[model samples]
Target chain A: MSPSDFLIIPFDDWVNFLVRDWLVPNFRPIFRAMQVPISMVLKGLDDFFAFVPMVVTTLVFALLAFKYAGRGMVIFTILGFAFIDMIGLWPETMTTLSMILTSVLFCTIIGVPVGILAARSDLTWKIARPVLDIMQTIPSFVYLVPIVMLFGVGMAPGIIATIIFALSPIIRLTNLGIRNVRTDLIEASTAFGSTPMQMLFELQLPLAMRTILAGLNQTLMLALSMVVITALIGAGGLGLTVNTGLGRLDVGGATAGGVGIIILAIVLDRITQGLGEQKKVETTSLRQTLISLFKPGAPAPAHAGKAA
Target chain B: MTSKISVKNVFKIFGDKPGHALDMLKSGQSKNDIFEATGQTIGVQNAAFDVKEGQIFVVMGLSGSGKSTLVRMLNGLIRPTSGEILIDGDDIASCSPAKLREIRRQKIAMVFQHFALFPHRTIAENAAYGLKVKGVSSDERRERALLALEQVGLSSWADSLPADLSGGMQQRVGLARALATDPHVLLMDEPFGALDPLIRKEMQEELLVLQRTLKKTIVFITHDLNEALMLGDRIAIMKDGEIVQVGSAQDIVSQPANDYVAAFVADIDRGRVFTAATVAIEPSTLQLADDTAGDAVRTMEEENRSAVYVLDGEDIAGVVTYQQAAAADRDSGTSDVPIADVLITDFPTADRDTQLADLYAPASSGLPIAMTDADNRLIGVIEPEAVFAQLSADPATPDTEPQVEADQRELAPTA
Candidate 1:
């Protein structure tokens, strides 16, 4: 082994001491203390806002459908939701979904800013890049060990594993997007007296968004793959069910859970992909229709409507 | 349009602490002294010129003349290390961010040779992007974008992606994008340098048409002599990061500012460049207007004419009748008949101080137009093919030899 690998041994030992010895024993008490009051606040809304699930889910699917393939998709998404309930898997499906949601949410919060920062600063990007490379290249199975030690083999462990696997795409794409902005366009923006901040938010970021969305798509896919792997650490969801059934050699149960994960993956993938595709098409077509619509005798192709 | 851009005593040096280098240079240090003191290379050296508004001002030179860098500074893309760029009496360095944005988004627009239309967007989308970014209402932006496309004659290609367009068409799209911003000034950096010959001509005409209609202030950069001549109202010839000369097209063509400018204009076929205004006309000495045909021939031998302007009083008429000249021989006791349909190239058709080398005897007369002075007097008559004859001597044109002595002038200059 190289000297670098030798140093990694003590680093692993330190991680074990902190996570396995200190965190597992004490972290839950600290987390529970924080959650108790928030749970009470949520308990008050739980009864009155039981329909919150239906409304939020509908809005999300509806907006996604409208943006992507259209209302045809919305009808199908609604039916998909109904099937989970009819199969008596509503609560379990929701639990699996929340886990996926938490993973993606945390990934975006951590990943996007890191991506943006890397895009702007060369030194920061150079430092952040190799770390992300390591995160992506390390075995997903290996990630479960540290998270299990720290977060103690539950949904949080599943979440942490998913985050590490999914975070790389966002940062890489964000860097590429910013770098690829046209020299003339950047100069034009600067000439306009756009402050450095204004240029970042208004010009550079918007232009980079399409690339960033592609990264997000990649991240979501990686997170979905890692979710099932994390189930071996005792996270209870479709993944945990699949893992449990496999342990007991229950083919019917395992197959059903596997099928359920596929269904969820397809739906989420389609909706997010649809939104990304729509944004790309919208920005692009707006520039093009300017000339196309003006063509004398070339009958306009429905220019009055939204690009979708 | 007025004086919109003035670059005064500008110097750009590439190195650490260019300010210190400039200060040292200003404090009696030579170029080599500065080089030794600061290890700096000068990008622009004491470049001073003003671009008049609504003029197609050309800055032309070989690579490293800093024309590209100069244009960048004009548009505030780069700040000068020393000296000032004044736009409408406002120094660019003094301008605020808001002011700069106002200038970039409103007053000026730029086109690049690479046709850097956004790869992701369609032609129309790329054209309308500036307007969209500037917060023009969608309807107005779309309307203006369409108008710009129509002006560039690319309305039919609105939906096409930039990648799909031909290089010439993509340059047009780049032009359309610049036009969409409704700019007061247009900055083009060799925008047609990459096209094939035929397409380059087409784009040159396209730009001429745009300038005619828009009357926008234009700053164009190019290294091609022919293109510089075809486009610039006033040209600044650059060499080694400094302008060698700045003058009108006529001045540059006729007098030439220096040996460099002379070398730049050399090898250009002057016969084609000169029009009928270059030639002279003398009244016909042969007075036998209506004499018998045999008598006209006798007068022709007596009064030798290169190209007799067969006149019908003060107003011009036609060439001498062959039969009249043939018959003049009998009246003059001469037996020879004059050749019919001889080309009238030497008469009033040639420019004053017309170099003897460019003159050629008429091979034929098909197309004819009169040259006039500022006073509207007929100087000479020239046919369309005369210019062609001079230019077609190109050894590259294997099919045409061009017998005129003028045709060989280009080869001798190089020799």
Candidate 2:
């Protein structure tokens, strides 16, 4: 074959070459550097004092429930949050909480709109689907390399990697939510003389909210799990303590952090999934359920034949 | 009523290769060929219709029949492929986006089948959404929303979010939202199509009541024929992206234009449409002529008379029409009942829109209903002779008719 006719490498092949040659060799040093900034962001939160105030937390959580679930949900959330605290691990848990929350917030800010765009356009879905695939499928260790390159170690790098890995579900769910919004409902909003903005805010977004919440729920859980892996990049939280303890053969400290992660995961996941499922059950049309609910036999209204 | 909506030849062909699809179809390519070649689907086709002002216009068909697509075209939800949709004489197709927005906000509102309640907002907020979207102040939105909820009997549920409400309650909130907008026209695409049968009926009646009070011009879409008959002032039956027939339920049922139209009528239980308003009533017999038989004979055989309603001056008299009894071509065996002895449902008639269940008698076949003025003076008779002629064509061997004819045959004609 002529030299001009030769193909050197595909992107995937090139990617593998880079990971094997440059990425693995340089990754450890970058993770060592991420330790500083991640620690600073987390220092104030210490898990216990780090709490964003129970009242504020309660109110925010309550508002979320009122919107997506129902009123009684707020009470359960408050109790759950308090119980997790009463069990101690306050400062350690708070540090982990801060990491999870911040990671999720940034993820949402990026993920939701991408999902919405995906839902809106076929091209968007096609484009976004692959990016998500890469983000999700790439090894968790592989994520540390990019984080290390940008932040050069510490909590920041860990946060970045955590964000990359855990955020896929958020984007996926958001897209699912928007796409799942019933076309009939959207048309209904438009026919009602709703402006584009109104239709978005009133119908499309609201109906899709359940799916979006599910995405959020999944993302939060993913982020929580990844934060520990991010500890390898010096993003200190419960993960740091766990990793360090594991390194030193101190099973007690590492186990505590692991337990804390599980608690936070449970608390967050339950609340979110509950809200999404609740919204699903609740939003079905009223007139239909009532007549169907009461009895097998009901008066067939003559006017039903005439619903003009 | 003026025609509020006018659609002139609308088509919506969906595909990457509409031209090729249309060409191949014309060139004897089947649907599979069109699909394989272009990945195209026809959404709606050459749909032309109008809705009169203050009239309840219903579009009905089964799923994928393009009925929903036609409704979407009304308010520009989906622009037609090639056509002009005029609302109040203004063609919406060429209108500016700003104007379309204005028309939607000020002129049209839709009630959805799913209710589409906002889980984030309370009933009042969902109800007030259209107004809020229209830039109405908070106070007015809330006030109107509350009032709308009250109209739907959901005033107490106003503070509740959709999640707290039942499906039917949420639907009430949906209605409240549409009402809050106060648009000149309300478009409902299967608004109650999702409800259970009983609740669907209740909602239907509720809509009728609301329309009676509000008098908003309504354009409703549904698949159920009975719903169209009960709710529509006029119904437009859609099939294969075209309106097979458009008329009152009685008109469509009694006078179907084709097989497709006949199919719709056949599926519906005719007990409701066959009302006293439909059967012709008696006319006055004020002539003081002494010869009763001679007079009856002369009146029966009058030249301009297709059918005469026998009546005693605003009071009903016996109806005795001659349809097949005096046809140019009649079956020899059935003609034995002389024209005079032939009893017809058209002779002892009521109005043309009478309820079948109302006139429950031992026998009401071949009985003609008389049409009379308010003073009880007979004017005309609605003879069932036409109905009889239709059925009596082959009485010796009554072929399989639908359940409706079997049910209706139970009410025998009585003198």
Candidate 3:
């Protein structure tokens, strides 16, 4: 035996054996239960994207982009969508959108409450912080190994892997947002005799909405990147197009797919970022929102038009 | 009179083992000794006082002197390590969370130094916060909040957000929020401390004016001796976690309990704290309505006075100067035309609680300022000599010497 053999522990091999033999067998029922929601959401998004005509989907996105962002973003979204459609990658783009949106939905649902719980309890925060650090630091491909082992390969497993990779930002930011809520406001709420739940909903949550929305934006971006990577596991999206193009050594096709992703990322990033910007403002009047964007020196929104 | 809020032997030690620290404190260990031995910080030590109803009770101390902690304990915010805080007969130290909330909801309202306004909410909404927390209906909350805003003279800005208002106006909104709840007690923790000096003065005057009609039992906390003297009917002076003295403004300024309290008192602007009543001296003789001009002259000569109040029994009918009395005597050619003929009603009269510094303007009318009771009876008079003596006696040399010089210069032209 070589001298190096003495130091080699084979820790990874032992963990792999334990996970395959013990964890998978013992948690079969839990994994089975998780599959229901996962498949249902995946199917729902896939079918929804499939049924919508390409032109109609493009118009809807353009309209949303104009409403939240402005005229500038609307033009960008239209150009992006038209270019993707012209390149014959419209379906793949739609599937990718569906997967990213699905990941974002699940991450927000699971991350926010956990973040609030962690913020409220020091013990929970100590535990969640290290787990989040690890989740963020690990390579995205490592998550695929366990996801594939538990659920096998397909769009469902791909979606699960995207969620695992993207969930860290939302949880971490939500915890930070809640923790950073002004101590003065909290004391004021307590002095005014708010119930614990009332303090959470009326005071803490409203104040933290901007930071949490920023977290959501980060999560969305992460999920977008991870969805492309998940294409290696039979997930159908622009990632597949890019992957196939790369396999055949077709640089033109790969470049086209990369352009489509850049367009989509820009559109999605602008929309989520615009949502965060809107929260900094007190007024929700469409006229004011439009006016303020162009005229930086304009007065703030009039009266109490804050979104109740 | 029954005390509205009574704090008895209250102690607040902040640390992991506050109970052990409290036991050590009770066993006659000093705050520093306990802190050194057990790593516990004493927030307040053996603080005992009574806040009477409708009285402005000020707790004044420098930062880290435990004044804020003591006020917070009254509302059950900082739970005392030992002893009792009784608000209207209920011990707040032993209150459960719900009961404590109820007390805060219905009995006490606190105004913070930073205003603590919700930046996202409208001024009306901020004003109505307390009412909303008490589960008042929206319509009623709106109406009451508007009325409170009106009281603070901010009705026009109700729809504006807190960010839109200036700092002083925002603090007014904070006051309006507390008033909207209509609680019996107001706990103001240096509410005007963040304001500009001019605005701070205006808010202090505004609070005093509001107190006149509101009659809320106000426990005001401040690091300013001037503010404490200005606002408080009774002042409690704290130092290093212990209440060294508790009394009226006069009591604190005149008779500080120890050297620490004396140092605090020394920094006080005494002209502001000592009112006309505190410095006024009783007249030796008065001109009666029936007293003839000759009789008035004899009394003035005996007392060596330039002027005297003409009394209608206990009421101040008017003032009769020696010149006016002498001219009347010469014109009438007798001392018996009645003192009413020479009685001059144009002289300035001051109330007992009027600050001595304010007496300058009224006293500048070249008249001895008469101190009057609520019934307008002449109680005493403030002479230039008495005013200068008190001014020069002030331990705060900077505030006194200049003011005395100015007063001397202002009178020099007249003299």
Q: Indicate which candidate wins on lDDT.
A: 3
Per-candidate DockQ values are 0.19, 0.26, 0.37
lDDT of 3: 0.85
Q: For candidate 1, what's the RMSD? A: 9.5
Query: Deviation in angstroms for A281 in model 1?
Result: 9.1
Name the weakest run of 10 consecutive residues (lDDT summed) in model 3 chain B. Answer: B406-415
Question: Candidate 3: lDDT of A184?
Answer: 81
For candidate 1, the per-residue lDDT at A305 reads: 34
lDDT of 2 by residue, B1-415 (tens): 5789888877666766677666665576555566777898767766676777888989988898888888877888877667799999877777887788789888888877778766667778888878877889999889888898889998877766676666676777887888898888888888887778988898889889988889988999999989999999888887766676676766667666566667567756665765554444343332322223334445657643444443333344344444643551144443233333432434343443446544444125544445444665554554445333332232122223322222122223321
Report the error of model 2 at residue B224, Å. 3.6
* TM-score of each prediction: 0.66, 0.68, 0.88
State the lDDT at B37 in candidate 3: 94
lDDT tens digits, residue span B250-292, model 1: 3455556556667777766555344333333344323224433
Question: Which residue pairs in candidate 3 collide?
Answer: none
Candidates sorted by DockQ, best first = 3, 2, 1
How is the predicted docking of candidate 1 categorized under the CAPRI scheme? incorrect
